[model samples]
Target: MAQSRTTEHCVQMPAHGAGQGKTAAPTPEKQLNCFVRCIALIERLGNALGTLAFTWATVVLLGGYPTALSSKDFRYATAIVSLEAARMFSRNNRLDYQLLFRTRGAVRPLGWNGLTVIVPAAIIRIVLASLRLGSHSYYGDDGHLDKRNPGDKTNLVPSLNIFYGMVLGQGALYIAACMLDIFSFIPQRSLARQGGYADDDRLLRKISGQALTMLAMDSVNNCLTMLRETGYVFIKELTSIIRVDRYRCVAASLLRSMCLHAQQELEESDQRELSYALREVLERTLIADGAELEIFIGLSSQICKVIPEDLAKELEDSHIKQRFVMRLVDVLNSYTEPSPHCPGIRRVILEQAINMMEHDSRYTNCFIDRHMAEALSMVEETVSEAENYSLFLGDVGLMEAREPLSSLMARAKQLLAVR
Candidate 1:
């Protein structure tokens, strides 16, 4: 019986050497395929090396190292091109090529995007060049021009030239690159909307949506920088001349659109990843300058709804929940006086808190037992005076604040009961 079974198994399994005995000659097509793959790998490596070399060169240039390639003009040009390439790489999500292929260490934390690094580095180089050029006049001892006599309003020429290059040339290129980044999502978004791949397209839609959201954030940052740098007079006269409401309206609309798109595309798993990423980023941003708080709050609100219990439990286990909650509380506490924007942010926080409570019963007891009193005290203090309430609720629209406040209070009661 054993011999019969062995014979049956041998007959069922094909001979391992059968194909080797009848080897077919390699074809031209097969050779071409191998050649193409080799070329692709080489090209990928070359691009990676070029990016690293440029990034290192940028750092060296920033450090004021006197290299053979360190001419002012060359540095400026290199900075612009390198920054543009970095932006392009980030937009295409190719920034991970090096990390994936070469790195042995754990992946870097993710809140700060490529723009945070590249844009500032480029701007610094340009500013340094401008300052250096500005310090000396073209009218030097070589019969070029005259030296400054008690600062004669400083040499405006070189400074203005630098400003023009940064604003017009490099700035235009950055803007164009961002627009292209945004536009690249259109085809993917279209495919998602058309249901081209049905459930399989969910991940694609989430990725594209996230990319667009990041691009929008970068664009907003760029615009804010432009306004801050160029519109000093406008900023001074902001209250009297410019209607803050109009600017707020436009910003809110843009944020709302991005949030809606991102929320629509995200699956539960996507939400978990996004939550993890955003929290890390938020923690970093809060520690840094906190410039991206508005965008962070907007996105957080969209993703905070109906979180999966498993994800909530994971976050709880990892202590992310406590950290995030504390950060939100800190944000709320920071705005001592009522601002137009504060109400929207507060509403989102309350909504998110309430969602957490509903999704995981443990969250209510955990948060309320630890943080409820402090959080409520901060909110109460913010809205304490009638004038402040009027501003907060009026700016937020009374109808909008009513529901969130009610829900938040109800959740608070539940937590209080548990405690």
Candidate 2:
């Protein structure tokens, strides 16, 4: 897995719609979890600060700002912009982090997501309150100490009180104290009352333009990770992938995994979307130049052989399986020679193709037209006295044929010839 260094620290979102009631008090585990949330919030804050600093310094030194904008205006603009950008980036790229920490361990207890949000929110409000209190310092108590904008509001920062910030973060305590104080009196309320309690959430990253552009690029690097988890994303890198010898089996294993998954959900209608996705995987790997990706000249052939009958029944009944059969037939038709060291790759595909055609008239015609007579006869002629191919994960080789590949091929040929 080509994981980023930050991947290890990736936190997962909480489960959706958890009916479990919130625990009354933080347990030892919960407290430790609280610490973790705090750390994550701190990490996020540090990144934001760095972005703000870089944004401010670059504009000030490199003269990126317009002549009308004061230094302070540019700094505040960057601050506001950076915060919004960071939050948006974090929200959008959550899927990437989720893909990395994909195991069950990624899911924290219910309400942890609430912590992710609440922790950052709580800290920011507290820091704001503290800054607001200090903004009125006598030594620096200029009229513009709070604001001089056309609509600058007073009580912009409440007193440095945790309870006030914890509850009324966006609201000020004494609006009459400042110019826009009247509107600050418009109070807001919500269900949460406990100090640090937070609940249901799902989202998960950052850096800027030029520099921001670089940061954005850095955060959007889930493509490589997706190739590990999703189908077909890695084919773009197939040239590099095939060079690594062990990756051959790894690629084959993906096909096997997709096959078993389709079989498990063969009867479910809702799975049509997923079935089609798997079908593409089979086609790209099996029907189209599947020979080059072979681990042992017949790796795809093994998966093709193990393809079950439920896949071959009816297109309406199982689209994915039907597609599986269709691709396997193409594979059989494309066969040049059977695996010299192993017999099952071509042999199993040939056998299953015959079985499916006999069982389903829909497929029989397709097979007879596509690969039934020509390909079957070609492989059948190469059938040996020893061609027992049991498709197992362990010992991936053609098993000793107690009854001979030629005999099995004879029966398959007879079944097709009669049809």
Model 2: per-residue lDDT, tens digit, 219-255?
A: 3233233233334333333223333442333333333
TM-score of each: 0.32, 0.29
lDDT of 1 by residue, 1-419 (tens): 00100000000111122245567554322332233223223323433444544454455433333232225534554655556466445444333221111111211112235445434644554465455455543323342433545243243344334433443334333333333333434543443344333443342323322222222332333223222332322122221211232222223323333334334443454344444444443443245222235444544454455244544655666667777666666765666544433334555555566666666677777666566657666665554222212111112321122343445655665654663
How many Å off is the CA of 139 in candidate 1? 82
Separately for all candidates shown, the number of backbone clashes (residues 3 or more apart, or on different chains) is 3, 7
Global local distance difference test of model 1 = 0.39
What CA root-mean-square deviation does each model show from the true structure? 22.6, 23.1
Stretches of candidate 1 off by over 4 Å are 1-291, 309-318, 381-407
